[model samples]
Target chain A: MSAVRVWSKPARVVLVVAGVGLGACVLAFLGALFLHVAPANSVSKQYRAQVDWVVYPEFEQNWKLFAPDPLQRNVAVDARVQTVGPDGTVVTGEWRGLSAEDWAAIRHDPAPSHLDQNLLRRAWDFYESTHGEGDAQAAPGSRGQLAERYLERIALQRTGTGGGRVIQVQLRATVTAVAPPAWSREQVDTAPHVRELPWWPVQDADREGLS
Target chain B: MTTPAAVRAALPRLLTTLAPYQAAVVRIGTAGTWGAYLLREWGNRRVLYGDRSPWSAELNDRLLADTHAFTALSWSDGRWWFEAVYLLALLSAGAVALGWRTRASTVLFALTVLSLQNRNVFLGDGGDNLVHLMAIYLVFTRCGAVWSLDARRRARRPGRDPAEWGEPRALADALAAMLHNCAMLVIAVQVVLVYATAGWYKVQGARWQDGTAVFYPLELDYFTPWPELSGLLGGSLLVTFALTYGTVAMQVGFPFSLAARRLKNVLLAVMVVEHLAIALLLGLPFFSLAMVSADAVFLPTALLLRLGGLLAVQGRAAGWWVARRSGRTGGAAAGEPVEAVAGGPVEAAGEPVGGADG
Candidate 1:
């Protein structure tokens, strides 16, 4: 016995209309994604307004996947917190390696999550990309502010209020050059260099969600 | 008929004539890869995006307020809600992989992935971006038309012949097919664009041009998971130069190779091997896997079927051997037909499946 056909004329009509609309939407989205990832140029600028809405937040992609040059330096993020004791004595904690912690977490696992591979690195990149080489403070409403807040949040999350009231947090990046390829006889300096950020006062805003 | 009327009449017929198996290929590749990734990273869900994340919901909300990137974490600042969202995402991914209620499940899967990815943007790499793009495109494709629970259910149901379905149903199905075909073509183009763009950028770089580009990455301590292996490989100057030049050539030539079946297949095989090496040597398995999955769209349906058949034969042989060794009859293992195991449209061999031109 033949089964009944469920889709009526009206239902099919609705389906066609919806399909057309959805198809157009998908096409538009694809165009936006293409334009968003394409190199920064005058052509891309034309579609920037339309593309930004589609590519931001989730779909914001960086296609520089090991292009031009790969990372040749191992960077370690170190943080030191100064806490005020009951007697008003300023006590500073030893430098804790934040990037080392991330490295340790990811080293053994073959399929480390994107977070393990990128979080600390991207956090550092966010800071570096936003701030000038010698800039002390991030400009308000700029990308630097976002990076500052992110770093601050990371600091607060990592170093909790276990010790005496934390007064200040100082973060620095230690860069060590990787050994030169065995094939290349070029003697590259493998020494560690430190770039220190100015000590940031632990503000009420920084500690907002920590409690 | 006049020219415009003839073209109009022909277009619908052309769309309906096309089958959905090609779309199914893309769906299986993307959904299956994503499902596996989700399952593998299940334990890290909380660490990646939940309350344990360093960036709080408030911080993310403040930063991403203008982007309208509303996440489940931002919706309710509770651990339970985060867990619920994670669970829903996991379930939806599985459903998408199984192609059960695929149309709805695809949407749910995309939203869940987006919400989680956006919640902690720092945790993702290029793989996540590719997944985002694929997920959006998959929604428009007739992805569950084959090798799916939906397909099985439909097959089981006693259905009227095409004559009884009437013209409206036929028209709707044709339109759907047309959209799926178009979406699949777009996906192919996207993959090509990625390769071409990457190649274009690489060509402009002095390092890539100088043939020392691959040398630096090999020397990197972070990427050198196996120092000894990297050293052995990087020690050979010829190998390094060959790899650097080959990568650029393959990437730049990919779009052109797509037109030629043999060259495309050869290039794809080389790429798969290259990605595998990267996964093993560089410790970027997910990224390699994601790229490999994307490349699967270019593989012919006939080739896939042959590979499937070979695997099935080997599996059955192994099962039969195990049964025999255990002093039991291999009848049960031998009873299942190889054809059943090698599922999908075997008759549609040499058919243009998942190819952009097709």
Candidate 2:
């Protein structure tokens, strides 16, 4: 490469010092990054907060892409809703396969949009992580309620406001295991397991765009 | 060995602009990937980031407030705000990819990447993470030095030498070069960490150990965008096992192979092909594109130069055909600057085969 340019001797020295400092900072950052991304261990655990401060938000790393084990099951999100007519007759709607639409949009398309690939999946995952087996808030007042809100927005937006004034919405997932090839000896139960979530009452905020 | 005279002699090497092509390719790669992805998702922008997003602005704001995270999306939950940031991201990605006003655009590139990706972190995959990291690192690089519009501006300048510049300008240029080298170094290290960690995690999986990991994902509805194509590929148990074992081997051995040029090139080629397969088979175009581009950081300058040459030749032929059809002459104009890009800096003293530069 052509030389960058020339600086005076003292200028060179100062720049060199600054460069050295920058290098050290980068090294420190890399160390923190390694700790943050590495599987939980003693040293990383010891410096958890410090590492988080450095690694969270922007510099955070997650290299575990289909690692340790790839996701072996197909989880499809389904939603249903209750609606009130002009005569105050409440109607419970059929469970709509929200995720089935996603798969339909995805199938045969080489470049599926993030809306189809991640919106329902990630929202459902958020809800799953925050809620317990009984559908109670696993960590109430933190992010559980927020996760529920996120899921409700996604599912309601996909299924629409139940043909009239919406009253309540509920979601569930059908997780089916991918069957192994005939040649392989590996045997996994190819059964579809359905998990129903608690019904969340439709809020004023949920009605804003439903019309 | 540590004499003052020797130290003084080598001190100036710090200011030398290193890996200009690597920087250019990375700039092009990351920005191209991001720009294409955004365009591809333009129809779904509202759902991905705007009002239709499952994670609403108020939710994003609350989450950001608790985590103390950084996202311009949290600035306002309004559709107008989301639209503005999305537009800016699209523009920045284009400008950075084209290397137009590169310094400012690179900063914008970083901001847009962080703002968009961090807004709804769960929406991304492994490739998004790499793009996220690269956008930040690319800011610290003098990535516009070669194959850039900025480089063309410099080439067209009255005096094309930094040495003839004013004192302050020269000093800044030197300092910038030093920073660029360091940034490139860090980028290289980051890629190594990614591979090492991925490899480490893969080796621990029982399916990976038993050589069946690659076969399972191909059958899943989510990953199987092309079921027939996937079925054809996954039909052979031997082929599946080979791909499985081969992936594990390549990833784990990648860091060690870096020091050996041929081995590294082979690994890089495999990685690039592997990413291409991921894009097609798994239907993760953006992720695979991001990864392939990130891997550009490790490519030697010579190979890039050769590739640039081939592209330039093709570009000239296309230009010639267009100009002929338009009744214009001098199609050779398109081929000239590519020479400047290839002949850049005379390969920089040939620091070993493993050096980031030629």
Candidate 3:
């Protein structure tokens, strides 16, 4: 029934072995994938290590896309820098909307860049997920500090308003809840929540690409 | 009925290449998608993955060490090393889309995608995620067996068919076919899993259950790139409800729909339209493109071939030869009219469009 066939008996034996071996591997791969992607259960939790073994690095999949719940709040990220002059005088610059810049680049453009679309937004998410309310770290220890560094680097390049060498940078986010639709009777508080982060001094490594 | 003798007889059947048109189209769509993404982000390349990245080389290396991921860029942290890998990624993506030296280009394509993606995981959205998965999966598929430069080269050579060419070549082809068929199955199953997981997860949400989930995202300033359109859609109850519940129904029922050919075609069409709308309305062209391309594997083969033929005519008009004929290299008669999709003798009767396998 197959189009290509090896007539030799030895070769046929080899083909059978190869096919059967591959089929088992395929089954195993699928099983691991299922365990990795499926909603958490006892079976998946029990085999967590085994699943991660097969699914990590490559073949890692996350389809939680707007699932469980979509983002209900709009978080606008802002950054400001403190510059030190040659005479040692310093002035704090006005807050610049980093998220606003991304939105401005995105507005009305049929094809917005991945950089404009995701970089700032994901940076915020990464930072938010790693840190608890206020300054506490999330379950991922030390990652909060890493996220802060990543966020700090992002803030440094974005706020060019400070003029002189950037010695310190601070970030703040305003989260506004999305209003319920007209027809829906869902009562929702639309107050904006503001959280200002602590000032972090700029490291030499953070200023690498900045002039 | 399921005895060892029967299994032995059926084993060689694995040598048949499954859904060549589907595989080839998936390859083209994914490679073209990723290449276009690289080009669009060319200005942001430094900020996204190179030395200027917030997630610097040191940080990326630290993360990689923890994850134990395979990325060629991790081998060297020099600026030149980054630029070289970026150039190679762009070149290999183009080569893969063109189906030139597919065997090698696919590997290079995978390498570039993984390298660049792993460098800055934060730079990705759902689209980059899809491309990342596709890059790894495309490595295992003989996606260039049809509708590609490799296929054209084989067609021109005449004796390149495994049945005619003996020994190692034949053995290699057989092995490729076995792997390819398995890969195709895995891709289809993977897509199904994605939908199933997404749909089931959405069911747990109060917003999704009540059908107000779509409205929130559309109303979001971040997602509302097209303000006027999104505002109109978000304000309208009819459109919002339809989209919210419609998406859930579509995603939830997607796996079941595959069992029925007519229903499957309808669902596939709807999914493509939905993804396209997501692209325009949500300002996620790359993600939408990736999703649409991944869904292409389930598209009717005949429709894909027709699309290929149309593209060929368009290409010829523009004074370019765009690998017009498909399956010609896999033992289709050389004289077979190019008007048709130009497939091999295996599907002599043309096999009723999108039924069964779909």
Tens-digit lDDT track of model 1 for B132-231 = 7788778877777665656655555535555455656655655666777677777787788778877777887876886767777776645656667777
Candidate 3 residue lDDT tens string, A43-99: 999989889999997787879889988888889999999998878899898899999
**Winning model by TM-score:** 2
Instruction: List each candidate's DockQ score.
Output: 0.40, 0.60, 0.60
Q: lDDT for every model?
A: 0.72, 0.80, 0.80
Tens digit of per-residue lDDT, candidate 2, span B1-358: 6999988777777667788789888899999999999999898787787766777777777788887867888777778898999999999999998778888999998998888887887798787888888999999898877776666655554353444567666676667777888899888888989899889999999989887788888987777789899998888889989999999899999999998999999999999999999999999999999888888988987898778767766666666555565555644455444444433323322221111211
**Candidate 3, TM-score vs. the true structure?**
0.90
In model 2, the runs with Cα more than 4 Å from the true position are A1-9, A138-140, A209-211, B1-10, B165-167, B328-358
After superposing candidate 3, which stretches have Cα over 4 Å from the reference?
A1-6, A136-141, B1-11, B317-358
The residue-level lDDT of candidate 1 at A85 comes to 85
* Candidate 1 local Cα displacement, residue B76, angstroms: 1.4
